[model samples]
Target: MNQLNVCLSPALIPLYNVEDHIVVIIDIFRATSSICYGIENGAEAIIPVSLVEECAAYREKGLDYLLAAERDGKVVEGFDFGNSPFSYTKEKVAGKTVVLTTTNGTHALHLSRAAKKIVIGSFLNLTSMCDWLKLQNDNILLVCAGWKNNFNLEDTLFAGAVVEQLKTGDFKPDDAAIAANDLYQLGKHDLNEYLKKTSHSERLKKLGIEKDIEFCLQVDLITAIPVLDGEMLVKLQ
Candidate 1:
């Protein structure tokens, strides 16, 4: 039987035995959600860079890719897009490659390199990600790319959602998983409304991107599971 665990932030990743677990990176406020949208919309692949310069260098080398870098909840200057689901429409990202860097999400992905497999998780592709997890039969570790190594509500809720879905499986959840499940139980009724008061929600709302928040909370908007293949994330078809 597999077990389910949760790490509220990447800072706590080292506390767990991640090398043998399937790490599902959750950044529901935007990053992972945007990645889900991009892949479902037919983006060729998403290369997650940890630094703005690294993302820009992909373009400097004349590689035909969209440069998406965000810091402090705003799009980094000179990038093609920010970490917003709306920017990844089928018409825009189809057949295109994206080099992505964000404040937390990409960092979490990089830190989780020791995992047996890295799967991107967001509410946008909730069910599909769960399906993939069921097939793996590996211990699950939901890694939340919280706000700069601090805990955040949205990611934990997403983690809780995953745990809630896997409740029937042969799994033993850790304390973090139990906490996340409690959070999910509290917010599962109306995710958008439940998360309205969260810091990240307020941060994006201040920027007038509430639409992205709503879209990010949507369940099963797509059926793609973004998995890290080498250095890039490609849809697990």
Candidate 2:
């Protein structure tokens, strides 16, 4: 049987060996969602770095890449853009490479380098992500890029959404996975409404980006699966 599990936070990442499993990294607030949007909008690739300086270094090298850096729910100073799904439009990001860094998502991506394959997951591409996972034979680990290494609701809910879809497959989910699935079941009906009171949601709302929140919660908006190929993320066609 195929084993499925959820790592609630990156702090628990050391507990698993991503080398042999198919790892799906979830950061629903924006990072992963923005990545999915960017790829689907025709961005060449996204290079995820864990630090703002690293993302800036790409500009120092005179690279033709858009620098997107966010920390504590806001855009980093000097960054060309923030981690907002709406920022990555076809007209702006098409044929451009994006170098991104975020508080939780990019850190999780750096930590998940050992995975056999790393997939970016968010509600925007929920269906496509699950579709890709169903075809893989390896064990599946949903690694939630929880806020600052602490548990967050949005990413956990996304893990559950994926688990709910994989129930018919040969998946044997662990306790954490089961918990996430239950959460998803509860919020799947009205994700935007259910997550409105979440810490991350409230934080983003304070910044007046609720539209991005609504957009990120919409399912199946895109069919692209952003898979990490070495240092950059590319759409898996």
List lDDT for all candidates, in order.
0.89, 0.89
Instruction: Output the TM-score of candidate 1.
Output: 0.95
* Tens digits of per-residue lDDT for model 2, 66-170: 999876657888888888888899988999999988768878887888998999998889888898899887799999999889999989999999999998899
RMSD of each: 1.4, 1.4
Summed backbone clashes in each candidate are: 0, 0
Q: Give the TM-score of candidate 2.
A: 0.95
